[model samples]
Target: MWGRQMFHFLLHWMLGAICFGFLVTAFSVLLSQLVITVVWCSLVIGASIMQDRDLSEYSPTGSSTSKHLSCSHALCEESPNCASPKQPCPYTANYYSENTTSTGFLIEDILHLASSSDRGSKRLVQAPIIIGCGRKQSGGYLNGIAPDGLMGLGLGDISVPSFLAKSGLTRDSFSMCFNEDDSGRIFFGDQGVGTQNSTPFLPLEGKYTTYVVGVEGFCIGESCVDRVSLQALVDSGSSFTFLPDNVYEKVSKEFDSKVNATRTNFEGSPWEYCYKASSQQLLGIPSVTLLFSVNSSFVVDKPICLVYGTQGDNHCISCCFFEV
Candidate 1:
């Protein structure tokens, strides 16, 4: 009877210890899972709140720094009527045309003038003749013929003849667009020779369309919408595109406000710059358009080339292109 009693006591203790161990293990598992859930929720909520705050700071209607102004408008502030009714925007010839060469003029005149020993005198004569034109300054030069064998022109110390040879549009057959008038109008063809203006002489429109559109504000992105269109130049030889400092600030803010937005920070580039893109609205920012007037008669479209960050907190870079 004692032995039986002792057995019953031992069995009872063993069962109680087993139950206690199971209860402790279950409680520990549940508590650990709850802690993990709470931590994840906190992180998500904090991220959402931070994003909202950043967006709030960037809304277009919010503050002076939030607003976007174009390069022309910025220039206007310093001079009366620079922006609008107070001042009249300057006007020039419109050179944009499906076919500028069809407007018959002298091709020989352009060649004779450019070939002159007197660079200064020739410039005076040729400057007004080149149409749809702007000057380009480049450190290096490359020559290649248009599909039709027309020679290319760019600025460098290289001799024009040697440049032409390198391009394959040897002096024997290539004609440069040497006579573009101030209105961005260009005229080309071998003058006094059997050569006439070639059709589709320069495929400039295709090459520079991106650069022009970007400058004109046709691009869609947080920063592009907030920054006003600024001065545009057609640069074919630049390694990449650039924008002024003021533009980068307004663009950078847009990405910072959104979750999963690409960082608009440039630390690994040969040049320091940043960029961001999104599909939503930011401060009612509007798209931009650029117009090019040639010979005060035609208007053509330019393309966006590049977008990058500037050094200043509010600085940005913008560059556009025009077809040849």
Candidate 2:
């Protein structure tokens, strides 16, 4: 069946795994959709070998099902360190974090996928995908940032979704939906429903590398900041939302002027706008909304998040805003 094989996967809050007969787990795997390349840490080259102290426990053993990709492959041309046609393809990917990088060789492996059929039947399919067998990592990777691996869902020929599409297994599209509990589902080849709200993906540097969207501005209750004209990346990998210093100042000032809660500081917390308030008081706080083009808006129903004390008690409400 053409374009009927829609792959599905489950997503946890901070961790997720794709079922491939066995599990391939990663830290922030589902949320790591912002990355441009799919890279998994090799057990032999994991944090145990690294000089850094912090590292993830999950690591997959080198499987016999995988084989090194030859440099002659068309995908090898995209590798920055492809040398000889007879050699294994080498690749290196850098992250937004300073000094963070994943360097390794490319390998071809069969991904076991489960798809639902038209008659509500389930079928298993095996598709070949190109993945980076990370032999070494630096910086954030050692600091618990996707220590196990990263399954990149960003636009690229080497990404898992792209490989599936090129193999004629499904359409070139995917969707990710996260619930309030942080659990979610990832559907490959899904075009989404007609009634769903949508926004156009803008290009970056003449190319679409990651999910970039144009923002008209932000709104804190009735007061709105119009024409801010911010182009932001829709990054689920990041735990907190970040804004420019100028924009952050404008937003923080507006929110502080309207809220009745007293501003206080929480030790060891990065949030600058912490307030001493009760659960009932938090409910009265104004909602924040991101204004987009074509009457589309993303609303944050709960802007104030609870910051717990050392004893695990709800001490204060903090606005999740990090300056970029």
Candidate 3:
């Protein structure tokens, strides 16, 4: 009962801050095994295409020219009291106005994962996927990475992790290891990473089951932001870090003061404070750290880095964070 309540509070609380990452779950596969999927949004002019016949009446601008566009639920045209055909369909996700429609824009496909074996039969695993057409993400450091959608690692029947477990190809466990040379690898099945930093995993059993961790607080520079034993989700799929409302306000303030560089002049930088990267600019940027709680009296420090990328001529000096 308490677990469910915590998940409920987290769901409502997370909306106040945009804490999602590029991928909800980290990609894991045996060495050299192709066991992950990428969910990138936005289709090119002709690079890829999907069928959405339901939205044939909508123009590129989302305006409806056909007065015959009726509500799908009613199954027929309405009287004068009903929604006009010129207006958007009242039953669709877009209410009564010609606006962005998700029906005709989404697509799906089958993905096959290759296993680590190479003896006789290739360990081939198949997974289902959903795709969508939309505008690519831009600006800030995320412009390059987030333009494509995330490969889902959430706790859903269709998520990549679930696919592996469903196919009997894996035991639903994976680990990631990073080397000093800027390269890393993921291992699946019973091959887990050996570490003493492991903690309790709270499996959110609601609509979106996600990997959430217990967070006590964050130590930023010399200041520590209080988290009051609230929970946080660790999603490497994201390009930036998101903090809860109360925690964010305090952390951002400390980060801003510590950096002390001139604010970025770029128009579309998503970070709250952007500074040009230089010898002097580098001095102002400080390392933001994370503190996690494993049990009573057992705490761990998660060292976080803040290295924002460039947008055209500007060189960003901090990673993305959100008040969400």
Weakest lDDT window of 10 consecutive positions for candidate 1: 10-19
| Candidate 1 residue-wise lDDT at 22 | 10
What TM-score, computed on C-alpha atoms, does each candidate reach? 0.22, 0.76, 0.48
After superposing candidate 2 on the true structure, give the runs of residues whose Cα lies further than 4 Å from its correct spot.
Answer: 1-41, 44-65, 77-83, 179-183, 266-270, 308-324
In candidate 3, stretches whose alpha carbon ends up further than 4 angstroms from where it belongs are: 1-114, 117-150, 175-187, 203-208, 234-238, 260-270, 280-284, 295-324
Deviating ranges (above 4 Å) for candidate 1 = 1-229, 255-324
Cα lDDT listed for each candidate: 0.24, 0.61, 0.40
- Candidate 3 residue 68 C-alpha distance from true site, Å: 31
Ten residues in a row with the worst lDDT in model 2? 18-27
Hey, what RMSD does candidate 2 come out at?
8.0
Sort by lDDT, best first.
Answer: 2, 3, 1
Better candidate by TM-score, 1 or 3: 3
List model 1 lDDT by residue over 1-324, tens digit each.
Answer: 111111010000000000011112221111110010000102222233344331111112222222222224322222343454434222121112211111111110021123333254433122111111111111110111000111122222122332334444334222323223512212222333554222111222344211121232323332234425443323232323344445434433432333232335456543332335443422223332322222111111211113444643321123312221
